[model samples]
Target chain A: MSTDLPEWLLARQEPFQHGDGIAGGKSIRRGFVEKSVDSMSLVFRESFFAERLASRPGLLQGIDPRVKVLTTILLIIVAGLARHPTTLLALNLWILWVAKVSRVPLPMYLKRVWLAAPLFTGIIVFPSIFNVVYPGDPLLILINFSRHFRLGPWTVPETLAVTYQGVWGALVLILRVGASVSLAVLLALTTRWQVLLKALNMVFVPQVFIVMLEMSCRYIYLFLQTTSEMFVARRSRTVSRTSTQEQRCFVSGSIGALWNKAYILSGEIHAAMVSRGYTGTPKTLVSFQISRLDWLWSLFVLAVSLFFLGGDRIVAW
Target chain B: MHIPDGYLSPQTCAVMGAVMLPVWAAAAKKVNNVQKTKYAPLMAIGAAFTFVIMMFNIPVPDGTTAHAVGGGLLAIVLGPWAACISITIALAVQALLFGDGGILAFGANTFNMALLLPFSAYYTYRLIAGNSEAASSRRWLGGLAGGYIGVNLAALAAAVEFGLQPVLFHAADGAALYCPYPLSMAVPAMALAHLSIAGPVEGVITALAIRYLQERNAGILSVEASSSPLEGHSYKKLMRGLGMLILLSPLGLLAKGTAWGEWAAGEIEAKMGFIPGGMSSLAERWQAPLPDYGLPGFEHNLLQSSTVYIVSAIIGLGIIFAITYIFSLVQKKTTPDKT
Candidate 1:
């Protein structure tokens, strides 16, 4: 079986990919070998998952999912209301500390949150460079190579200008995006998916939506696993065949297949749910209980926020 | 895209809130009506679908990533009211749970993306497709066109909202409102980019989703088809009347353009026929007050006055009439068929 595996697949299967090293790999090898190991790893290390682990957690995790959801929303409102970079940075750092105390792995958190950097940077870059509203001194200029012309006497050049204000604006945007993304990630990681759904339901996040999310998440994994197996089987049968378009088509077809499977699976799942006496509401054996620690944490966060607001007022004055 | 508190002047935010409140209330009330209740589940599903799809961003040439808002698709699948409610809820969730948009700007954001774009697209689709039994191909075409127009309109709306901040708020540095790269440039650039790219992405996604649901569980989209009847004489006549209104409304305002210009010229001549340095003096007087528009400078000369007024009027009237006609048609059709 090992000999039949492709070099690329084998290389990706290394223990370090799991971030647990060789020893940890050996311990889990028995169970891991039976499952679609690649998918399991991919699912575990998805960027969003990592981001969630990096965010802050709280008493909401200990309380009913619904209560936790309300708090999460309240927290987001507080974060969104912050305008200053200092406030955002301070909030981000506090959330980071919370994640740290909660024992989320640093590497996973970084890996996930880092994916947003390029996209966020792009949004700010253009606005900063050609900012018509707040034009500052030009930092750089790029002349267009293709579009060169002469006007009567003097030569005319096509150029794009980048300004200092643009750079500053870009930095501010990055900080804002970082703050928001971090907050969101923290919520996802600290709370279980089910709890989060329950919390949403509690907050009047329409029941139909909650149900859709639950079903989608549940079936997504199954779809991915089945598709991965099908892809592997196809690859094994069609060796030495490679084309980007073909590959895309194959993946899309596989997605279509997964959609069909999901359609059928829903009916089966619904039947099974009915048999188990499942109603619209989900049942959890574990009840949430908030301790003194939750109250202390909440107050601390509030105080920190207040301090930032006070500082903002002082600065404005 | 979310503007935080303190970015816009308090006055601007308040005005946006005032406009948003009534529309939101109306949407909620419409959603509550028994006839619209059948669409509730589909709306919920559509919202969830939008949330998930937006997460998968496609990179653009400028290194920026763009995602389809799915507003047009929702409007096409469900009626405008249902789409408005679903998109509003989705935007709310994203802001609250994901921090994707700002809280203070939620009302503004909802108004622009949820209410304006989808309604615009739905109307456009109705115009292009006409009053006929909408074939599967036409539905797909409508979905594509609507999605494209909806996303671009939303982006434009956001740009205008941002641009108006300084003027509406009386901010210290008014330069932001009338800069070399004013809201006009920013709004179009953003709108065009999304119009070209994200529009197609949304169109395809919408088409695929509709096709999927239609094939497997036609019941899922039954509310949409039933409520938004594609065939009706009253609706067609109403749309045609709207189109006529849009084309003619500008005439009412601009009809006296020549007279106004003549009157202004006569006044200026009566005061002093080509007074030496008269323009310079007038410029000096107005420069401080209207630094961007009123400033007595070469910058004002660079802009064509008639062109700006005419274009703005046409665009504004066009949008207003288009949306009005579309909503009226949809309401008329959906009323009797309400399950």
Candidate 2:
């Protein structure tokens, strides 16, 4: 039975020291386990930074969470509705200006917004610039075809060049995405998660749904941390790299285990809360109060959104 | 698919939101009845489960890692209604916390992932695994097929939404304002990526997880798909909605063009520069009882046309109910009675 066991189960490694008298050695190669752990840590770090950023007394922090949420949603919708690049550019600038006053680091903030989803959107829309795609005035001819010929369904043009109309359209789309993402990022960076969930009622989200969102946000960390620890334990016991089959088995087992834990914990969580005099509705010590300043700031943001909407409608060709 | 904001036009986003509203309402009611007051904690945990599941890196054939969205598995275990709420909450967290998806496109994202993926997958699995034992291979294979079908359908839906943009909206010069790809490109591109890679990954992961649960906790697997949530529901609510829509049918006369695909041959020619030869030959094959929402004699009269619109709405609703009634009667007659 002992001989049939894999190498990982045979014995501990030599000089593989970890803290608190536990044997551990950093793996030489980065596998999926390490990658997942690093990713989880990155998530925790991002969340921690967001909490720190939210604690700071920024311009958005001064406003009530409901007002802040409402204004941010309005601005995001405006960004989506905006058809002109100029309007989107202006919205992006305004968002950055608020982020600057909110004590959020501009460089990190910009990178976070631009580097993730919008960057992907930019790549996806890159091909629309070609004349064959948009079929308009040639802006930059990249390839001069031998002659007009059919390549399957599409007719090949004399030259494959970027078009003015395509470039303009793509620019507008990219700017719109940038503006919308910036507003959303700024809101997430400035507001506490629990308060933000509560404030979703301003958008007519049901009370029960908001409560669900609050609890889920609170537990995402718990589950991620728990899963990360499992990886840490695996990393500690390993001397050599595991095979892909073993890795996949570990992953599937981890998922199944987590699901079981979640199912059991859900019952326990409700029972514990009930014992602690809990009700169906979530309660917070600090109640929401809208002040005069909140109203004024919210109104100002609303006015700006309207202006952008008008500008987009007027300026779009 | 998590559609980012600004990708879909405002109108399209609004339409998707409208489409999801009833599904959300139904899920809420169904889950509430099942879990009662205990739904919050269960759904929250389920949501967190999916959120963490998406973080797991599955090894691919290319020696790279990919993550499954986990919608299919959630539907399999938690049932469709609960899965809908769970995935929705997870999506909301992603949108608000990590800036992963568009804030405004939240509805569209939920419509695709939370509703379509879960419902389609759940039904597919249930259809294939009907009356099978908990440990049967047919059930696990069904889970696999469900996952594959679920993700691919979602991809197709996302592709169609993206493809519709150029056809529905554009700059005055014909440059696409939103997603630039036409249907031919968007559909095939999205389909290939999902069907070849994401579909199999999602299917394998779902099947593996289901099999693991089958071995460890057969009780949970047995409880899933045990009964329909809306089995005892009344038709009163459905009737009321149709009544309201019938009353409001005349308002649709305010729009100029017919709904897409319902256009006449002349209107098709006006929009597309020419009617297809097939459509031209088939144009006079049959005539609508109420042409353009009006009676034959009431076409030129505005008041009569509006009245006829209401009548047409009633006729449409009547036909639908008649068909439903016939189906139910047939189902009743076919089933064996213990008495």
Among the numbered candidates, top DockQ falls to 2
DockQ of each: 0.04, 0.23
The residue ranges of model 1 lying beyond 4 angstroms of the native Cα positions read A1-10, A13-84, A114-133, A136-170, A200-291, B1-41, B51-70, B85-113, B134-137, B165-182, B204-223, B227-339
Cα DockQ of the candidate 2 complex: 0.23
* Predicted complex 1: CAPRI docking category: incorrect
Candidate 1 CA-lDDT value = 0.52
Over 4 Å off, model 2: A1-29, A277-286, B226-230, B234-339
In the range A1-317, model 2's lDDT, one tens digit per residue, is 54888898687853223332233554443567767887787889988898888877656766789888888878877887787787677677667766776668988987888787668888999888888876789988899886999989889899999999888888888888888888888888888877888888878888888888888888899999999999889878877656676777678778888898899999899998788877666665448988766676776676667756754664563
lDDT of each candidate versus the true structure? 0.52, 0.79
Quality of model 2 by C-alpha lDDT: 0.79
Candidate 1: chain B TM-score equals 0.58
